[model samples]
Structures are given as C-alpha cells and as structure tokens.
Target: MRRSRLTLTLALGLLVVLAGCLGPLQTTPSATDRSTDGTTLSTTGTGSVDAEADLAVVSVAVVATAQSADDARGQVASDVERMRTALREANIPDDAVTTSSFAVYPEYDYSDGERTERGYRAVHSFRIETDPARAGEVVDVAVGNGASEVQGVSFTLSDETRAELRAQAIERAVTAARADADAMAGAAGLSITSIETMSTSGGFAPVERFDVAESAAGGDARTTFEPGPVSVSVTVQVTYRAA
Candidate 1:
C-alpha cells in the first residue's frame, strides 16, 4: 500500500512539472518579428579611416570664490561681462563665445562635516573658438578680465575638420583590415573567398596643449601671448571577413 501511494505522488509531481513547461509553449510569437516591408537583413559590412584635424576646439572655464555666495556670483557675472568685452576688443567674434556653466554653491568645510557650510563659490565657464593663431590671446584676455579660478581646459576638432580627418582615417583602417584578411587568405593558398562581414571602430580624441598659458596672469605683470598651429587627428577601425 505504501509503495502504491509513493508511486501516485511521483506521478502527480511529474504532471505538475510537465504542465509548467508546456504552459508558456502555446504563446504566440512577439510582434517585433513582423516587419512592415516583410523583409529581414542578415549581412553587414563596416570600414574605418584616419585623418588629422585642421581645426581646434578649446574649452576654457572661469571660476570665482568669495566669503559671500552672492558677492562671489556677482563678481563672476561682472567678470564674465568684462571677459566678453575683452574678447570683443581683441577682435574675437561674438558668436565664438559660448557660456557653458553658471553655478553658485556654498563653500563647505568638509572637515567640520557635511552639516556645516562655509563661504560661497561662484563659477562661470565659457567655450571660445578662435583661429589657432589667436587662441593664446583669447586666454590672456579672459584671465586679464577676472578669471580667477580655472576648472578645466580641453581641446577638440571642429565639425568640418573632423569630417575631413575621419574620411582619411576610414580609408586607412579599411586598407589595414584588408591587408590582414589577405595575409590570412594567402597563407591558406586561397584567394579571398568573400568578405563575410566588416565593422568600424573609433577611439579617444586628443588635445594638443601649448603650456604657455601659465603666463596669463601675475600681480603686476601683463600677459603676453602667442598661439601655435593646432593639429587634429582621428583613428578608424575596420574588420573584414575573407572568402
């Protein structure tokens, strides 16, 4: 009698397991598989190129701090206006000056803990684009007008130049990938069978920095400036498949 009861329980467990497995099997396919055009794509190819940038995008931010948050903010605002005036005086186009940040925060004495607040800090950041020849002058003009705090400075290529460099980089990367594929085919004593697939890659954009910017300010000394030619570069990656 016990053996029969045990067999009956085992059969019940098996039925439960089968029911769980088969329940979801009856569901309809998801709606995503049906395309409006009733077509599917299965193959893809990608290529890469490398080129040097012809233009430089430089980012400069000016920051200010004071015992009073309001005073600090007011000072930064005034300085920003003066900075614009100075840039205009230096013949920088108004369109080239863009404000990236305007922030006011309480200066905190973290040593006392997050609960205690100290003075205030005000910051205004600007993005300026000028001829590579005039970048140095723009930095000087900005600092002379009241830029006391420097948060970060970086450089990039302008859109037009970047496109140009990208084209070259792509071509080079494709050539390289092809060379690799060909080497594989030759070692096997087979002509390229077919390009199974291809893909592209991109990496870090670099900024060429001239260190002379440090001389932009001193208590009694005027900042003299000079800008050098800017070089921009782009790298492309490509993967190719063989016959």
Candidate 2:
C-alpha cells in the first residue's frame, strides 16, 4: 500500500513538470490574423485605357405571321434568305453572319377574359459582325431586304486589342498602387518594407448607342456610324508591410 501511494505521488509530480515545460497552446497564424497584425497597409488603385472599337455587331430579326405554322415558317425562311442576300451584296461574308435564334409559336388574343388563337408567328434573328465604318450600311441593307426589327448595335475591341489594352491598364494600375502606398507611408512617417500581397481585376467595354431610325431614313444618303472609344479599366489591391 505504501509503494502504491509513493508511485501515485511521483506520477502527479511528473505531470506537473510536463505541463510547465509545454507552457501554453501554440496555433498557426491565419491570413486574417497576419493582415490585422497592425504592421501592414492595404490600398486599392484603379487605371483605365481608352481604345477605339475595331468591330461592330448588328442584331436584326425578321418576323412573319400566318394562319398556319408551316406558312409562317415558310415566309420567315424567305425573308431570312433575302436578308442574307442583302448582307452578301453589302460585302459581309457568309461566315460573319450567324443565325442566333429561330422560333415558331402560336399567337394568342385575349379579349374580355376570353382567350383565342389568332395565328402562328415565326421569328428569325441574326447577328452580323463587320467593320465599324460599314456598320450603318449593313443595317440599311438588312432592313431594306426583309428584316422587320433592328434590336440594337454594339461595338467591341478585338481579342488582340483587348489583350494589349489589358496589359497596359494593369501596368498603370500597379504604378498607381505603388504611388499611393508611398504617399500614405510618407504621411504616416512610416516606410514600406515589402509587398505582402497583390490582386487585380479587369473591367468590361462600354456599350455605344446606334440610332436605328437614322439608318432607316438614310435612303440613298450615306449612313454614318460612329464607334466611340471604349475604356478598359483595371483595379489592383495591394498590401504592403510597414517598417
């Protein structure tokens, strides 16, 4: 009995000594913890590049209504062919004109809470890409042929142009971020030691307005189109360590 008690006392003493050696729990610091360590500054800078749009996309649609679905579809097909011919005459290649949507559905007429089937309506929509200078002419040709509706026109930069602009915008953004950090550090009487983290995001091209009425009324007059400049913006968030 005495040996057992002595053994228990020794075990308790050893556990106390081990606890003291271990001290307290040690945890790995997280990203949030490091960011709020009171020794880092975070700032965001934005930059933009203005570039002329090189391509134009015209949205056009043809619609026809008839007593039968087949009849409506046939009429739509004919109109679509004529529109294609017009586009071809305007020098728009076959590959540049793409059929976006085609549908045929029954029309409904509601009067005095009574529903009646009026007729079948068919619709065919096309997307045409061409030079910005010739966008107005393309629209006129399509409208004069058989296209009943002009859905709006939009302009955009080509892939190569977009890439080039993106690079320039990012470079400007980084420079702006560095300048901002330097200014803040100088005002606070602190010096930037190193860059901790950086992140960037890109902006989209703005839509330019295209007047459908002007194009329709052009007649023999030259249809003028202006694809205004589009701005490509880039924003950068940078975190710097202060000393």
Candidate 3:
C-alpha cells in the first residue's frame, strides 16, 4: 500500500510539470466579454459647418510691355502707383494693399513655328484685402486706375469667424460620434458605460473663388461679386466601453 501511494504522488507531480511547460491557455474575448463590459465599440463621425465669408482678397495685376526693360518697368511702376492712389481714394486702408509679385521678363511671340522676341514685359501684382461687400468696388477701383488683369477673388472667413466656426464644427462632430456610439450599442443590446478613447481632426474648408473679369467686361458698369459661404469640417473617432 505504501508503494501505491508513492506512485500516485509521482504521477500528480509529473502532470503539474507538464502543465507548467505548456504555459497558460490562450483565449479570445467573445460575447461574454462584452456582457461584462470589457469590450470597446469604436465609431467615426464627421461634421461640416458653413458660414458666410466676411473677408475678401482681390488679386489685381498691372502689366506693361515696351521695347526696353527700363521703359516697361517704369510703366508698370507708374501704373501701380495709380492703382494704390485709387484704392486709397476708395477708402481702402494703406495696410490692406500689399504687393504680391513684381517681375520683368522678355515677351515672346510664336507664329508659324517661329519664335520672335516681342518686347520686355513688366508685371506687378497686388493683393487687396477688404470686406466681401467691397470686393467689387475694390476691383473697379484697381481696374479704372490701370490694373490690366484681375486674377480672381478669394472669399474667406476672418480669424475670429474661423475660430467660432471651428469650435461649432468640433462640437457637432462630438455629438455625432456619441450618437453613433449609442445607436450601435443599442442595436447590439448593450449600453455605453463610458468613453474609453477619443481622437479628433479638423480643418477650415477651401475658400470660395470668383472670377469677376467677365462681369466687369461691361464698359462703364460697376463690377460686382457675391461670395458664397465658406465651410469648416471636422472628424472624430470615439471608442466606447459598453455593457
């Protein structure tokens, strides 16, 4: 009887050693884990907000061509001065008128596959910042004063407006994310216990661009532009713990 008891004890010791060598059992979380609120539900939501543009940047250029580079530059400079004077008369602040680019290059004409040097060309571009309501007036003022080219007009929000819109967009995105999480949890017969993790990303939308050259083509007619709303968008990813 003593020998039998010793053999049984040895067998039990061998089983424990084998179990140790195998390590712990591997298991995956399943429905039971979700019931115990150990599972996470993740969802992504997006939001967009549109607001009327309050600021406008009008791009105007003065171009001149002459046989000599000096002559062309002189002409362009004179034209730019005239435009600046006009803008000032129109009540545009001096700080609002800024030079965007100035260049002097040789002009070429390609005809019948022959390239010929036409003349030296000078161009001076100006960016005039103003309110959207005055963009048309500003364009007219520049054109009447010697601006030969109207590049386009960009309508966008001011810094304060952008900040306000961004905040509203983010709030909308968070609300959307919570709604999605709640919907998904409810569909699965679970309730969101808490938000485990969340991340957000957003940005200001593209500015509205308008070309007023066609509208301004009518002689003696005032140029006008109606800008649309600029948008702000945001996206959020949320992970919720559910039971």
Top candidate (TM-score): 2
Question: Please, what are the lDDT tens digits per residue for candidate 3 over residues 1-243?
Answer: 999999999999999999998997898888767645356999998888999888999999999999989999999999899989988888999999999999999999999999999999999998999999898899889999999999978898889999899889888998999999999989999998988998889887546554444544556567777677788999999999988
Best by lDDT: 3
Task: Please give, for residues 1-243, the per-residue lDDT of candidate 1 as tens digits.
Answer: 999999999999999999998785565667896643321112222344334334444466667778898898888888888888988888888998888877899976766355667688888887777666565566677787776644434445667766666677667656655676666666765555445445555643545656543343555444233323333333334333443
User: What overall lDDT, based on C-alpha atoms, would model 3 receive against the true structure?
Assistant: 0.89
Model 1 spans > 4 angstroms off: 1-53, 110-116, 152-155, 213-243
User: Model 1 Cα RMSD, Å?
Assistant: 14.1
lDDT score of model 1? Answer: 0.62
**Poorest 10 consecutive residues of model 2 by lDDT?**
211-220
lDDT per residue (tens digit) for residues 166-188 in model 2: 99999999999999998899899
Ranking by TM-score: 2, 3, 1
* TM-score of candidate 2 against the unseen true structure: 0.79
**Candidates sorted on lDDT, descending:** 3, 2, 1
Better of 1 and 2 by TM-score: 2
In model 2, the runs with Cα more than 4 Å from the true position are 1-38, 211-222
